[model samples]
Target chain A: MVKQKSLRTLVAAATAALLLPASANAETVKIGVVMTFSGGAANFGKQIGQGMELFMQEHPEAFGGHTVELIKRDAKHPGGDVAKAAVRELITREKVDMLAGFVFSPNAIASAELVTQGKVPMVVMNAGTAWITKLSPYIARVSFTMWQSGHPMGTYAKETLGCETAAVGYTDYPPGKDSLNAFQTGFEAAGGKVVDAIPMGGPREVPDFTPFFQRVKDAAPDCLYVFVPSGNHAGAVTKTFADLGMRDAGIQLIGPGDITQDTELQGMGDDAVGLVTMHHYSADYDTPQNQAFVSAWKAAYGADSTPDFMAVAGWDGMAAIAHVVKTLDGEIDADAAMEALAGWTFESPRGPIMIDPETRDIVHDEHVHEVVKDGDRLKIKVIDSIAQVKDPCKALKIGKCGE
Target chain B: MADATRARERATAHVVTAHRWRWVEAAPWLVATGAFFLLPDYMTLGTQIVITVMFALSLDLILGFAGIITLGHAAYFGVGAYACGMLSAHLGWTEPVSALFAATLVAAFVGWLSGLVLMRYHGLTLLMLTLSVAILLQQLANTYSDFTGGFDGLTGIYFDPVFGVFEYDLWSHTHYWYALAWLAVVFVVARRIVYSPFGRSLVGIRENALRMHAVGAPVFRRQVAVYTVSAGIAGLSGALFAQANTFVTLDVLGFTRSGIIMIILILGGTGRLYGAFVGAIVYMVLEDELSKLTPEFWEFGVGLALVLVVLFARNGILGLLDRARSLLAERGR
Candidate 1:
């Protein structure tokens, strides 16, 4: 049995050798992108890939004549096992210079130890857990954290929306918990009382929010803040709220922009109208940079597939990588790359953004937008903007984020 | 008297051959030793393969030798992982060896309890019962998020160096050896069990339970015993995974995992001791390569490979090799 297996192994190794790419050029920078490229969340990977491609195409000189090679791997699901294995292979065999693109927080959290051990600088594109940066010193986020939007939304809910009492419904996970804590802290600090905080369900599937919504309706708070993940869960929460007629009861529906994601907005119909959210980027932003980005995205991916915050994060993440590549002159070192990324600021399609040196997390503008009906389609109308919002979980030294 | 003496002589020879360590049996160990020195970059994958082989070996004990088709084998694996993870993360029991033992014990106790109920059923009903047990555990783990970490996974698990000498290096050289050592020890014990009189009795029961019962072999008791042992070994594999990865997730108890291991066992050929080794290496390597070639739909490649195995090598890769070897010998003659 062993001898036959060994023979088969030799055959396989020979085949792999034949398929192996030729030796890398001196200026080539390989970035291994690990994301959910298959399964239900495949769109996250697609959007992020498009964003990276767009940035590279638009800024040809960004890498300073170095050829950028992206080796993409499918994480498949929110479960971290596949992602962990993919990262290991990328680091060990492929010997990728940098790592980017994790759609799920669990996947990012799982790869933290590997990146630290491998001494690879990881640019997180879209995992929102606040404490992820604290896991590895070689990590930095181009994406926004839960606390960045959730904390400000909490204050906005009380002072701007004039909601004296509120209820928060969050998907039960790490990011969910972080979102809940951030919102509650901000709300209470702004003199608003939290009537109820319910963990709806896990983030693996689109959970039915009927029961949770009914519970919130019973409490009858002035406003309801929810934080589910940004894909199908958001649609379910919107449908549930509409079905339950909570808005008719004069209870304001509010959350982070996950509920009003651009790609999901039109499908939500007018039911999404009057739903207010605080978030980083929106495809409908009227700014010149954002309009240009939206047009380029529509041109590339088709008019129907709107780019969401994940895409923006992917774009900004690539920009950060490009910045590192340029500053280091294509000689990528983990410590040097991280140093170049620290306090790096750029005018993004989302407006001005920076990597906070202290926490190694993104600092960006948080826009409070209301979903409004524009002709036959729903649109995001920015009502308020809070510039340069840092992750409050880190800023306030809350829980594990302080460590 | 002459016929009986001849039979006794043949039986003694069989026992001697089973007891003796064949030169061919040492080949895989030598290959593993070579991989440690030569394939330094692949040590992490090597460790994973070793861990998987251990898990598959445990499955072979009951599913192959005892004919107990369990779909929820991951229940024991998940139990072991969580037990080990909680030990190190919550209780600060960072010692790898003792923690593994404790985790294995918990999984065995759980298995023994479940085996009592499982021994009463067979076929589809038995499969469903096992599946339900795994699903129940998964739900319980998810609901009690404060303890298990729920879907986000349990982190902060750190292990001390093995025997306080070899640290788990970034290259995973130490991890490969540590897991390989455990696998070697378990393989020997498993080989012994499968070749013993009790092991023959399991094959007897698998072939015909009624006949074994008529012969007064206490079928149910033997089945339960093998299951408990299998579950313990599986738990040990899971503990190794948790310790090596230093993180535990709900995927440990996932349905996909249980299915994947069953497929691996069938692909290597059941009722063979070394089948686990061949199956795990093939499946894992195939997955690694296929995913790289086509990241979006890599399962398509894996599915194609499995279909070919089922159609051509019905008894699996080992059975195919055996047939080819015999054919060559016949031609030589």
Candidate 2:
């Protein structure tokens, strides 16, 4: 009897030890982030990482007394098989509680599928592919879809700029197509005609756009819409356009946030002047939240931190995750965390951001801005704000968007 | 005199004898293929394997049977992919037929064009020329945003069913079967070519180009022809890939893609037709598993494995299996 009692006591002790640690660790949520931290997209990833780090530094605790841990994997820029492999690794090996941060749509789609199949909650940071919100409930995005800015940009081009005919040129990819499609739909709806739509490969190909520019110039469109994303590509094209004296020929250049935030555009000096773009946030948003973020970012990264739009996206993503965790009292259950995130609203650097209950995409404002020289530095000046744009997926009836 | 006669006869027999074919020689490969294909179907690994097999078979024509080495195989692959993507998006052609014609013609044309430059060079020069072609193509794809659909990629491409019978769905299972069938066809064609007189002459050139030239072999023309054919096969694989994923990106033409395909061939033991298939499947599976264990550091493991394979098993997994089989056979004897 004595020996049996002692054995039972030992078993009880072992069970307690295991259970206690497991329970304790349960409160420590592990989130996997896959982003292109190396190669071409490295700058975007670094900005995201920095934003998350800043959020973590401020909040310390994620939420609800839970500790947040991040497992980072580099989705190499110019991503292909390596990015796919990284996503599989994050899901199967690390077994993260949540997955997020695919900057590109291909990587986003690949990672989203793996995470959704694993039944993990995923939040996209910078990728704007409409398919993410439309296809899966497991995904929520803090940034605009590829089409989001296009609608506002189109409206502004017609109503604000009073442009009658707009010629569109973009890369021949999903995001480019989606953006142009959205712009066309919105531009046409606003009684503006899209004179021409030209598709190019991504920034890798340094295309001689003399023919394209000549065609657009010959068409004599009131506004020229361009959507080249990469810095080098954007700069080269801007220079080429400037060199051809297209600006002087009365063709106004307009595009998305990528154009305004591109370092290459800044380097273009006088070429970027008077170019209009649609974006969610600019470095000069004039909000306390934005001011604090800019201050923190500048302090952390140095004074020459030419903040890209991705920096704001990264900041918003981290803040949203932090807010949800804090509201839940540090509990890390996927369903509960998702529920908490649904109704959550937070002041982001880009004004007020709230998770749309139906689509799970963040509902925010899109701004139309003109590139203006502010004291020696060129900055985007907001001319108009398209407030409270809902998730486009809501209209498609694909998900429970806007719930 | 009798002993000398016996020695001469032995030497003559050795020269005349061809390599023996055995069921045992194929048993391990058969088992491996069965395991890789059948087992992976249950896990959805078969789709990737099937695509990779097609990629390898395409390379086999140029690298295995022919003495040509290309570092820009993915250029043709990307061209095929883009052609299919463009045709499907613009023409709204059905999947299989479009894939058949687009992949073949585009890849053949690119290969033929490249062959002019590639055929002029040999050794590392050919490799560099192929690399330049790939880079140039990638650059063109990126620069001409009006056609190639830049970084955002061509989206929402819907492929109609094959002959209105088999539907092209998003589920990767259908893709597995389609790719597998194509791979089989490519394999049969490759096998026939490798065993034919043309194949023997190519091998002869590989062994002694000077001797083959003296014997009046049009070596450069043959090399170019084989390279073009190989490119068509590679293009076919790319078409299937574009169809399967319903998307095509610039990454398809990237140099790293060509490098990975070459690695697969080397890992499986090049110069053997079946080695490409085996190597591709094994490399993908290892990559899948390794990435699951440690996402960030999996490349380190892959690098280590490559080093070990190079140092100890020079002939690759197939060579190791052959050695093991020989050892067991000797013991049995």
Which residue pairs clash within candidate 1? none
Interface RMSD of each: 6.7, 10.5
- Ten-residue segment with the worst summed lDDT in candidate 2 chain A? A5-14
| lDDT (tens digit, per residue) of candidate 1 on A192-223 | 99999999877777877999999999999999
Runs of candidate 2 exceeding 4 Å displacement:
A1-26, A77-85, A111-113, A209-211, A262-265, A323-338, A391-403, B1-18, B21-54, B75-198, B207-250, B253-255, B263-333
Q: Which ten residues in a row have the lowest lDDT in candidate 1 chain B?
A: B289-298
Q: Chain B alone, model 1: TM-score?
A: 0.96
**What is the lDDT for A125 in model 2?**
90
lDDT of 2: 0.73
TM-score for chain B in model 2: 0.88
TM per model? Answer: 0.91, 0.72
Give me the displacement of residue A244 in model 2, in angstroms: 3.7
Q: Model 2 — TM-score against the truth?
A: 0.72
DockQ of each: 0.31, 0.17
